[model samples]
Target: MATANADAAEVERLYELGDRLSSAKDKSQHAADYEAIIASVKGQNVKAKQLAAQLIPRYFRSFPALGTFAMEAMFDLVEMEELAIRIQAIRGFPLLGKDAEFISKIADILGQLLTSGTAFLLSFLSSNVKCGYASQVLSCISEENVERDAVHKALMSLIRQDVKNSLQPLFKHVESGSEIREKIICFLRDKVFPVKAELLKPQAEMERYITDLIKKSVQDVTGLEFKLFMDFLRSLSIFGDTAPRESFQELIEIIQAQADLDAQFDVSDIDHIERWTSCIYMALPIFTVWPIQLNNN
Candidate 1:
């Protein structure tokens, strides 16, 4: 094994070597240099790890293939006992995107972290750290013109199979009535637009789930939670076409009841008029179709 030097010259030499190796089209030469550089940096100090991280995005942009191999190797370093090394690895996941197996690799890494007994992985997902990776994956898959249905199905599969109970942890941030609510609302709103009808239409039990979700959202509101409620209402109204007239009537009653109760309680903060307007509009399309059928009969 070639010894790693403690001197700054050795660190710069390795960083520069990695940069050059990134462009080498000869696969064997590239791998040899990449491995040497990774090994050198592992033995070097924290500064070397930071330099390696800074190089990763560029590596990804240039030698995307080599970057994939490097990123996998970095995972071990991130899981290392050294904090600096781990930070470097965290910064390196973006490079993994170039790999065909990136999504599965990321999902597996996140799954392990999420299911681990310790809170480190959960905490990682909380704020800027982990969510970015998820967002990146979403954007990459969506932008690459990967099959929309496949991506949607994959997410639904995870929700249904792996993370059914785990969703509540992610929802806590959404439920906290903070800025994260906006992100959650945007995500769910997008869901409503593209795939909501398809996802909800096949299940006979969808009406019940929809009703329960909307009612729970309304009931869960203690303060001015009207914005998210409106978003949900818009989605429900847009996608609730397959629901029965009874479902529509039940929704109308829920809105009217809420409005009446709010008035009696002097809930000035509540936007009763908007809720009423939404319900009225939501009912119009259904009612119009029904009347046509009735007249034809």
Candidate 2:
């Protein structure tokens, strides 16, 4: 077909542009070249679109200049049949690892990707493909230890702006049976890795901010969310006696609510009994308190 030849020519042109951007020695000049490529791809004739698709990924990891430009161009590429390009975009997050500003910029792109209505972008985020890198990004965000307000805002931004409906995957990480909760606590405490001195240092403003969040969790309706919120509190070593007291009260409330709900149900039913048995067994040691022996008065 004559159309096939046009597609092939378009592909070659995209590849040439990628090569130019990748090898360009001057930073500003290279950026300009990639911008030209962006314009070329955007204005590509129908047959050229197919060619552009094939070059997207190849140019993605080419160089910082090209990589940054490609990332910026992703919003335009989503509608094209450039699955490889989108995949590269997700995978390339690691390249932005060391620079907070660049990482934030890419995070903005990720926010856009989530709402692009493209299944490929969603799958890239929610799928196992990006989990390891995603974890790395999370680790960086936590380590930066900017103020608590800033950290909370960044985390909330990633969840609310980027994850959207894709949040189920992250929520699953904090589920009742998931190991991430324990992992988080262990990492922040002296168990897995010793808490760094810097992390232990106080920021009055940040603590006050976190204290407010702790207080708000008490009014949260979702039991799982409340539990996860508590777990998050336990991970942050800065929480003091006041926060713990509030947390204890919240915990008792949750336990009492569970007791009341269980009492209203017929525990004799096989399925109910099974569920109750698991809950009680799990709660027994976890909820139990042992009386300390003392000298007789």
Candidate 3:
């Protein structure tokens, strides 16, 4: 029941598809072809999924109405257990760049994959590792997760527009858990924290933006997010401290805002205990570099 064209080499197959679409009496009538391609992406075959990844972006122009459907299909591809499949799909992200609305979705995918997603389960970030060496460290530490570099490059490219769209998605994963929290932090530590100022706006502007986000959204953050936000502050203080002396004071204010030093909770409540435990555990890094502004000053 298979057509000779279906099993052709990639280049040949794509050529035939282009001719078919270009020469067709009515392109809309190819809905079945479109559906078949979408179904192939979500199918069980690894190679087929890989092929579909390329096809999704290629056919996107002819089917602008299916951009949502195209993105959904790509989402399914990113989650595949196969590394090649994931990278193949990720490479397609920038192709979708023409559509700004997909930025948030792309951010969510990047954050999840870098965090606890099955595709790229990562080791905890090597702490106190000096700057100028993140790339080597990431490679050595996360060998099986080679996709780290791909995802990082994709993230950096995707953030060029709608930069704030990446914030909520990336921050949502920074919660209290083993692999989830630590690995995502590692991504920020290695990929995000140490970027040269030229990559985006100046570090000072970036710092101010996050500062304002925290000021406006601190109450909305969970215990885990608060803990993560503190870690983010610590990183910014270390690598991009144009606001150094002032940030130390601001850090004190943020801590005070989140703490109820005199308030007590049920001793048996495990969630409360864990949150406090994480708070204390996380603070060790903060205390280690207490008065961070001093070095920068």
Candidate 4:
């Protein structure tokens, strides 16, 4: 048996050998070298295991017949005690994505990490949603008991991708009366309103995305949802700026669609409670809270 402690020279020798095998026309002639490399992946040496994890994926396209062994070896590395080695295996996942069926299998394994956990194991988020990897992101965030920091981090990343890319997948799954929808909207509200409300801070690039997110979230909302969220939107100085006015204009249309009364509003007739409440709901966000100064503005 070869010594498990693979030296630097041996690692270089194996790497150079694989470089030849990568371009070789008749790889079957070098079957012994391939087998030896695979064996080194299971060797008790850290460097050899990481080397195999990297090499297998790098030359994945070159050797079609050994894919199963390569994938299993990668998965084994994913579970290894060493973080660097696990990262090497994880980085190889996309290389193996050509097989959609196999990609789903990989997603399932990772979904467990992203969505589920306990103190006894490596405690990261886990996923229960069955969807393509793109949609899986939203599923993880939408899930109950998932940490707030994770959701916020994911939202930031998704918004960075494109605001629409973040919301479409999320709202696609969020139905009427869904806790998921409610939480998403509420989180968006809390994330922006507290900071924006306090300071007339100059618009940062991220604020633009957050503004777009706020605008998109209030769409198709009405009744209690529209009253609460759009009112918060109306109060933002962020929207008062020239740069974001167009975004706010579109959002105003969304507000009017949901909050505008069907019949002409009778302001003096505070006689009817339902009508008066509707009037108040519409007026509160538009008019500053100063009751006496409302007519001046």
Candidate 5:
């Protein structure tokens, strides 16, 4: 019972400290208070940790000098066992790295998160963060001043390195009504696909890559999966002038097969038929016109 009382007292104390930091007039005193809160985070106090997670971003925004320390703390929080703490850490990202000067640093940190902290970070962002917010963070990293090409290359390399395994979590989120669907599609369309189209050659190796990506996106028959597959096709169409004729033909065949399967369903399944038909209709024009477009180009 005494332990429970102590925990309650600690939570209240943390909240009081948060209030004090918010209203503190002296800049030095505010920094000192923020540092104290950061220290309290190390103790076995859940409330302190939560409050610290919430305040770090604010402190980083208010005091640029504290950003390096705040970011270090945020990265540590990313690995925390508690979901709430991790979520708050992810939330702090936008504020912590909002300045133009911090974009490259943010990109490097994000690359690390992608490489080493893939599962939980991706899961949390996909399920928890709002749709456009993810795109915003990505856009910051891809800004002109930052190493856009390098970051894009690293991201595509990660994707191509394990197209199936790396994207499975993202695909699962799309299937489960997560906002990550829009974020992933936007990132691919805006950052990766455009650059990749220029670099990709009409070679056997490139064909295999395209084939693998399409096959992975089409592996499931869920409605959301179908939508994601269509989005992939749409992204490819943006490179119509550069895309190989044979690759487009293969994609057409895959869509046709899906359409045929949809036709096999009973008339009562009008919704399924309509969905499949729409995808086929949307994709057909791009696939059919690509060869002509390439010739014109």
Candidate 6:
């Protein structure tokens, strides 16, 4: 009974410290307070660690100037075995990377993490909502210009090394109608497509890679499944004016052929019919505009 009471008191104290950390106004002062928590027995406290993870990003977001210090502190937490702590630590990277001044500092650490933690990060992608955060990190790595070349090289190397093993698991979740699918589509858009023109190898190799991905994703589905495919294709079209025309045309032809067949199918189930109609509706804009855009270009 006495130990239980002591534990309760400890919990309350940690909660109060978390509240103070959250409300901390001065950057140095907040850093000091945060450091104290890390030094305290509460540093290893699970709840305290979770609170620190949540608050560290909030602090960095609110005080961009504190990013370097915050990120340095975060790097320590990234090594923590706890998933919650690791994820929150990972979240802080993209937020810090948004600032150009921080990108160089952030990129090296991110590249290291991506290289060393590829399996862990891939597991996050297989997770439902966590995948969104993971994708955001990849997107930040791809989009930032400061250290882009090195970061992109690291990213692509990791993808090429792990993607074959990774894609099979990802495809299992592809049909779940989760944001994982959308995040992957965006990742491919931002990462893969841009590099096609610059890859040192034969273009067919790159086009074949893209084509295989599309086929794996769209091959088994019809009706509503095509909706995910259409959305993915539309994202691809953002670079339609620049994307490999043959590849884009091939995907469009495949989708158009599927839409045509669905239109003619006997539609006794209204829900199925509605899904098919929606697929066609989604494809219309892509089908109509892509050819015209390609032609005019």
**What TM-score does each of the candidates earn?**
0.38, 0.41, 0.60, 0.40, 0.42, 0.36
Better of 1 and 3 by lDDT: 3
Q: Which residue segments of model 6 deviate by more than 4 Å?
A: 1-14, 21-31, 37-42, 61-68, 115-297
Q: After superposition, how far is residue 60 of candidate 3 from its true place, in Å?
A: 3.2
- C-alpha displacement of 86 in model 6, angstroms? 0.8
Q: How many Å off is the CA of 255 in candidate 6? A: 33
RMSD of each: 12.9, 12.9, 9.8, 12.4, 13.8, 15.0
Total residue pair clashes for candidate 4: 7
For model 5, residues 1-297, the per-residue Cα lDDT tens digits are 997788788778767777887787765557777776677667776666877888877766666777677777877776677656755665565565555455445444444443333344456567646755777455433432233333345445444444433334444433444444444544555665555544345434553565455565454455555665655554654334566677566666666655555346776888767866766675667656674222211
Regions of candidate 3 where Cα sits further than 4 Å from its true position:
1-6, 9-12, 18-36, 42-45, 59-62, 115-143, 175-179, 199-205, 213-249, 258-260, 264-297
Q: Which model is ahead, 2 or 4, in terms of TM-score?
A: 2
Clash pairs (backbone) in predicted model 6: none
Expressed as tens digits, the lDDT of each residue in 1-297 for candidate 3 is 244335445435544565676687777767666656767775566667787787677666566677888888888888777778888888888677557777777887776666533333223243424455677565545644567677777887776655567655665554323345555656665776666343336666776775565555554456766765676666663333454455566675566456533458778977667665665565455446455432222
lDDT by residue (1-297, candidate 1, tens digit) is 244445676677766777676667764546555556556545546666666655654455445546556666666555655445554555455445434445445434433332221233344446545445887554434432322232333334443332312233334434455444443444444544355555555344553455455554454443245444544554564336665566555555555554453454434644665555554555466565443222211
The Cα local distance difference test for each model comes to: 0.49, 0.43, 0.63, 0.53, 0.57, 0.53
Output the lDDT of residue 136, model 6.
63
What global local distance difference test value does model 2 have? 0.43
State the lDDT of candidate 4 residue by residue for 187-258, as single tens digits: 555653455532323445444554555556554554566666656655555544443435444554554544
Please report the candidate that would top lDDT against the real structure: 3
Q: What is the Å distance of residue 240 in model 2 from its true position? A: 8.5
TM-score-sorted candidate list, best first: 3, 5, 2, 4, 1, 6
Question: On a 0 to 100 scale, what is the lDDT of residue 265 in model 6?
Answer: 68
Instruction: Give the distance in Å from residue 86's predicted Cα in candidate 3 to where it truly belongs.
Output: 2.0
Give candidate 4 misplaced runs (Cα > 4 Å). 1-6, 25-32, 115-297
**Local error of candidate 3 at residue 148 (angstroms):** 2.7
Cα lDDT of model 6 by residue, 103-166, tens digit: 5444445444433344444454577445467666674444333233433444454444334333
